[model samples]
Target: MAERTRPRPAADGAARNWLGLPAALAFIALVLLVDLAAAAHAVLIGFLALAPLLAAAVDTPRRTAAAAATATLAAVVAGLPSQTLGSLDHLLRVAVVIAVSIAAMYVARARTGREERIRRMTEIVRVTQRAILRDVPERVGGVTLRARYVSAYQEAGVGGDLYEVVPGPDRLRIIIGDVCGKGLPAVQLAAAVIGAFRQSAIVRTRLEEVAADLDALVAREPASTHGVTFVTAVLLEIRGPRLRVMSCGHPRPLLCRAGGSLVPLGTGTPKRPLGLGGDRGRPDTHRWDPGDRLLLYTDGMIEARDAAGRFFPVQRLARALSADSPEEALDAVWEAVRRHAGGPPRDDVALLLLQRLTPEPDTGGCGGPCPG
Candidate 1:
């Protein structure tokens, strides 16, 4: 769902700029000191040329130009006391420093333009992805819900994993899936799958019809996007105290009951991933009681590997999610996953946590459990 996001503070950019100029000045000073101290033994003033180049990396073009000018002046000044200022060696050093500084300024300008373009593109992609997979509400049809999307591609924050929570008249419909490829094509396919699911989940009374619609949609995608593309999905319909799950070659969701009991739901044989044009098996029925938590996630959570190549064991570490609320629980789970993998996930991860709230007695809350 739409997680809270904060823009990068201006101070961050200011700090970067601050660092570059001082660093360049420090390098120039160091080179001057070395050149003056070692003048009797060796020539080292040429090293001043690196000051502007270093500034180009993190400073603006104007600052870079300043650094270049400073470096050129330092080169000439350092050569003066040694009586070598008019020599060909010192003249060549000054010329090379000027040329290098000019190049560094141009490089800094080009790099700045490219960085701005990337920032704009990144913002656009983030908005588009958020539109496709809109945020899930905190409560839907009496169920508390929390969702998260993590992309392995940190720069883009876009991937093929998708999920949606649709509130029905008396139930909550949910779908989670993973598209088969990467890049923009995979993101497109993921959007398509979510679009199809959002449309069908409301009208189709049965989960099978919704699954069928998604399968057909993926199968019809053009081959040009990829040789062949398919999506592994799971369709869920939560009605009252019962949960119906249908797996399309996706991972089985974990159910965490009160007092720290965890069970894998949807044990039935699964069908082919969507787009393969195969039969989607019947939905598996499970009892979902009050205060129970259901964890739905893409395979990325389980397949995450650590430095020693050991796959993350979600089932074992799931007890960490015993928090009082789904959001807190999810944060704990996400942290555990990152710790297990020793870094950010290597694949797209989509997580949806559903909790059946327990009503307080005599407060107009439903005393009995919700219908199945």
Candidate 2:
């Protein structure tokens, strides 16, 4: 029950108090007017019930019930001049109001209780997500790094897209993945995969060994996969002067060499996504020099569509390679993607970029950015 407790913010409570004042005043005004009416028709007396109903909008059920009692008392005292207390019509009108007020209080309490429960649950989910996802470090081991995760529209801001960086003594291994499907099920699988990768990435001697561990972990998950739990991912090992990559049916990462040149990495072939059976990712090593950048991302980057239904030009990232740092470069990529999509993305988006910073420009164009 405590887990379901959602405390209303002080600002919202303040707003309710301000609004409650007017509602309470409206009750008093209605009660006074009914008393002033010389010929109080039975119908005119029924309007007293409306006062308590208005109180339900802004006040707690207890306060609303108190206001209802006050209103009922006013109606009885005020109605004395127009009708005898012994009259059946007057007695019935009083009974009608008392019943309506009690009912209003009950309805208000039930509705408020349910809403508070939902608010509490949502808050818990947000806290849990932050703990699991963790923040990307601004700079690590002389390499500037930046990452971003965006949930799809009208969602809880948690998605199947997941990424993590495991920095070692002199090397850093990174994983960017997109779990199949969407919503809670997808998010759960994403967590499982990331958890496995994080635990094995630094400990496992080889990159393929890390991928194998993750694949076995996903295979054990209880997913209702119709043969495809698209566990697409890009795993990278970055050391002093080399970048070793292993792709598991994921999008090819972009490489930005010194002097603002960008090109796609790897041989550009689709390997089967992990968790579908054989997870084969041969080690592809690249000459990672100082002032070089590697951008890793999920499919959402390419899948985003504009207002005219045009796909976001991921190729446009090449033009943005001139950015000063990994953080600045990602900012440019995100802005471009947003502009291209014309608004929020239709799916979850994840972007991660790494920059090598040793001053010696090895812009010989082998592992350096080339024509995509």
Highest lDDT model number? 1
lDDT (Cα, tens digit) per residue for candidate 2, span 78-102: 5566656657877888888899889
User: Which residue pairs in candidate 2 have backbone atoms (N, alpha carbon, C) closer than 3 angstroms, thus clashing?
Assistant: none
lDDT of 2 at 129: 65
Please give the TM-score that candidate 2 achieves against the real structure: 0.73
On the 0 to 100 scale, the lDDT of residue 157 in model 1 is 75
Number of clashes recorded per candidate: 1, 0
Report how far off residue 343 is in candidate 2 (Å). Answer: 4.6
Alpha-carbon runs more than 4 Å astray in model 2: 1-98, 153-157, 224-228, 256-258, 279-281, 287-292, 317-332, 335-343, 360-372
TM-score of each: 0.92, 0.73
lDDT of the candidates, in the order given:
0.83, 0.76
